[model samples]
Target: MVPAERRTMSPALRRTLVIAILVELAVGGWLLASRVLRVPPALPADMVDDPLLAAEIRALASRADRGGTPEWRTLGEGLLGQGAYAHAESAFARAAALAPQDIDALFGQAFCIDRTGRMAASNPLYRRCLDLPDRTEDGVGRKPFALYAIGRNLLRLDDVQGAEAAFRENASFLPAQFQLAKLLVRDGRLGEAVRIVDDLLRQLPLALELHQLKARILEAAGAPAEAFLARAMEERSAHLVESNFSTDYVRPFTTRLGMPRVLQEVESRLPPVPGDPRRDPAVLEREIQPLEALVAEARVPQRATLAFLRGALAADVDDVAGITAALGIVDAAGDRSASRLELEALVRDRMGDAVTATALRERAAAMAPSPQLHRRLAEESERRGDHAAARHHRARADFHLGKAAYRRNRLEDALREFREAAVHDDRHVATWYRTGEMAYHLGRRTEAVEAFRRVVDLEPDHER
Candidate 1:
């Protein structure tokens, strides 16, 4: 065997070995070259940090710094600041992509999108920034700012529950002192929001924004006297701000800071009504016309507020027609105003238009998808003697209400609640046909017959 193995290699075999070795070396060389020469994949085109994009971003930033001609960032900021949402949105979108993680750019983009009536678009950006890992010494994450942005966006989208959830989530992140207490109050979580502001006020006593926020919150929570006092303090701060600045500067500053005063004046001007006769028709009608006029000229938030005020005035005067009219105005004023829709349902109920009211309530229920709205609609259906419709609405209401009650350990209450619900809506077809079912339930044979007769008429094969 050694003798055979040791024989000299053949020319063809030697050539093959050499060829294989050369191929391997060639492949290895190619791989090594690829590794050394290849560039890393570029960051997203919009991300301003990209080396390739840095020059363009720097150019834009320089232009913004110049501040005379409208540069991308400055134009966006100015439009956003001035509440020209649609224009701001276009500008900020460009800026955000150019500087992806630029906090001001992100905030401006999100705010402008939201202002331009695009809550769905704004929410994701707010969430992304809010979810960013915290590097601050406090380690408190961006939760507060994120929560506030989300809540504001939800409010604009007419998602009250979603807004509440977001506000509650970041309520703790609010700088132990900030000036948005009023927003929290309007959110119906006033107590918690107020506590945060109170702590902040202790630290930054001279902060005009805090005082204004506190006043607005107090006013929203129905603490008029405290709000008035807070307003006075804020006014003093406004004067202080003006006195500290040049005349030209003061005028612009006051114009920007005058929201609190305008709000206070509006609240103060609302006429008081007597408790026993809250709905003084004349006063209600008188108050509504001006509010309607305001609705026509106001922006989204202001218009929504005015519409709500008009609705309240109409309710005070027991003017169903006025209330209905105000609701229509509110509905037309903005896509984000659902509170007005809710008020409209109430007005319809008060007007004794149960059938139409039920439909309106159902529409609201569909939009907000709330248990309360469903319950109201179910009750209205029961009142109208539409057992089938009543059953459907009641089942939906009971399903949600039961979950709510069960979470609170009210099992018996939930069961009784459903049982009571069943009395109003006999779901089974047999309930309609049983001889005494309708009579006993309705308390009148003729009424039962009429109801059953209608059911039978609709369902030709049904028997009584």
Candidate 2:
């Protein structure tokens, strides 16, 4: 963890401070010149506009001055909610001085400090808050939110492992898990991200974001059909009017001459495999050759993806030169996405430059903060014997590619993308609604109804 003295202020905090400084500058020195020593702090009208909150602050201040029981803690909490962090911190400090054992005062103080961009200084107070005795139910001895603050602070410090540990310490806290998942994805450890999100979904089945995340993971893992199913669930969970498209296991196409149908036509013309045909490498290569040739001959920009696919086929056949040639074409076509980086890393790895390969992989992983990337990074890092880094980068990827598919109105492709996105971010109500709409359009009433039910469950006020 970064020590307070060594930790640099975050950009957001710096920006906030700069804005405040600029406002003070604009107001000139009159305010500062008029200030008195120990001037009684007044509530900012915008923050303490509500009558009840204003009254509560006034009452607490009066009680504190009279040496009454420390109702100042309650006032602190009210001020904190109103974004009056400085006043809240003072109130909490007073309450703590009056009642040393008041855990709420310690937590409130730490929370206020943290919110005011003094995270490093707040660390010790957080520890003190958590160390207090358990007075609430759940018997954890500390408020779960304390762990959340600790996790967020650790994350800001780039202490990925520490953040993960803190987040896992309080499993019921959703934001911690989400943060951990993001770190995992950024590090390219998709499998672990999937497991974390999957477990969370079991508890929060109606969470649209989680489902969307899972879908994205599936897509990154090359499970298009599974992604499609996930998208269906996500769409069904949305609050929008659902579509009626049936879920199909086909890539979306602009023309009626869709890839799936075209592939079927080509398959009918090819010689049948005698045994386990799908596993026949030679046959697969032969089948893919025509597509490769077509892609090479085509002048269309979108066909660049076909070149990348051909590179994958070459890799499967251990055709290093073929992979290089195909990838070179993709590069020449000006593709620089995470997928392109991943392919470059793979080729470098194959060429026996382990160091360069690993670096490239890391770069690719960093470029795409997805579950799939993290999973791939984990695999690569584990291969290089860096289990800790591998473990840290194991979150799921999102279904951006699938969303692209969806945008083209390629119902089947869109469904797959939405499903993949939902897997990673199940709380994505939009995806769930789209899935339901598509399912309904395809006359899959049962599936549509199930998806619609999820939507209703997620958003009780959702219109059908």
Candidate 3:
């Protein structure tokens, strides 16, 4: 970790400070001739206008001056919630000084410091919170959050293994679990990531990001049907008109709990073993019953998924008529989603109907810009001598690739990708912001500032 004394401030913080300095210089340049500059002393709750809140703040201050840990801790929590980090830090410090064993005070102080982006300084303070006895702050346990904070700091410091270990220890904490899964994905531990994501979905089935992430991971793992199901889940999560309460083996599209292995066996097309049960037409037809039942009972995404799986199983047994019938239903189900369309396209492509598959895929790509799909489209477009279309698809692919690289702390690669993305998609705020962030990390200050200025120009309210 970079020590406070030697650590350089992040680009966003530096830019803010630089702008403030310039404003000060501009205002003071002529005014200095007449009188010395006098800065106003920042006071706690100075501008608070809500009568109840202001009175409460005053009361907290009064009690804290004469009282101990609880009063100061309460005041600190209040200030922290209001984004008054400096005042909160002081309050928490006073509380910790009076009662060093107060986990709340220690955590509050460390958290206030962490919010300022001084992770190196706050890391040890979080460790201090842990060094003491395990305790609860307010109504929640502190250990999990503190461990998560430590892992976050470790990741920021580029201590990948340390972060992984910390996250592993704090697996029950959702943030820690998410980080661990991301790390596993970065390391190409797809099996591990698959399990983690499955568990996370069980807890938070409606998390759109997790579904999207699983889609990407499954796609990368060469499980297109399962990936498509993940994308289907992604679409379902977005509406959230109804909560998805189902989770577990019965949940569709899981790798271990579902049928990626069976699908893999079918897709491999190796000579069947003499008595392989899956290759038996009778057994395959029997397996189709449960899937047919599932399709009947399930909704758009899951119904589509079950139909596709049934088709795959029927195809494995060379039941051409059965496969065609099942796939026809799969094609009709989940028609509103790109995932369903993509899955249908993949099946059609596998069945040698390239023309129809291409059309469906192109439409799906337009709906949701999948990096892998875009990359394939870019290749196909280039083959068709459509340079402009290829470039556009390639640029989108580059942006997402940069994001993946950034997630893994591969900063140099991320910078390259974002720089390329910036060249193609200059009007996009996300591209500029990503470009600026990567440039700043890679020590290209001028480029970073220019990209940041472009982002600000595009979206004046954008911060970081």
Name model 2 segments beyond 4 Å from true.
1-56, 137-142, 238-464
RMSD of 2: 27.5
Preferred candidate (lDDT higher): 2 or 3: 3
Q: Whole-model lDDT, candidate 2?
A: 0.65
Which ranking of candidates, highest lDDT first? 3, 2, 1
Question: What is the overall TM-score of model 2 with all chains considered together?
Answer: 0.42
- Cα lDDT of model 1 by residue, 69-143, tens digit: 235556555443334456556666666666666554565567666656677888888787764453364443344
lDDT winner, 1 or 2: 2
Ranking, TM-score, top scorer first: 2, 3, 1
User: Which digits, one per residue and each the tens of the lDDT, describe model 2 over residues 339-381?
Assistant: 7877776688678877787787778767766655666666877
Tally clashing residue pairs in candidate 1: 4
Per-candidate TM-score against the hidden true structure: 0.32, 0.42, 0.42
Residue pairs with colliding backbones in model 3 are none
Q: Which regions of candidate 3 fall more than 4 Å away from where they truly are?
A: 1-45, 136-139, 238-464
Q: Among all windows of ten consecutive residues in candidate 2, which has the lowest summed lDDT?
A: 241-250
Over 200-305, each residue of candidate 3 has an lDDT whose tens digit, in order, gives 8888777777887788789989999888667645423542211211121012223221233334443354223435655565665565565444335433344555
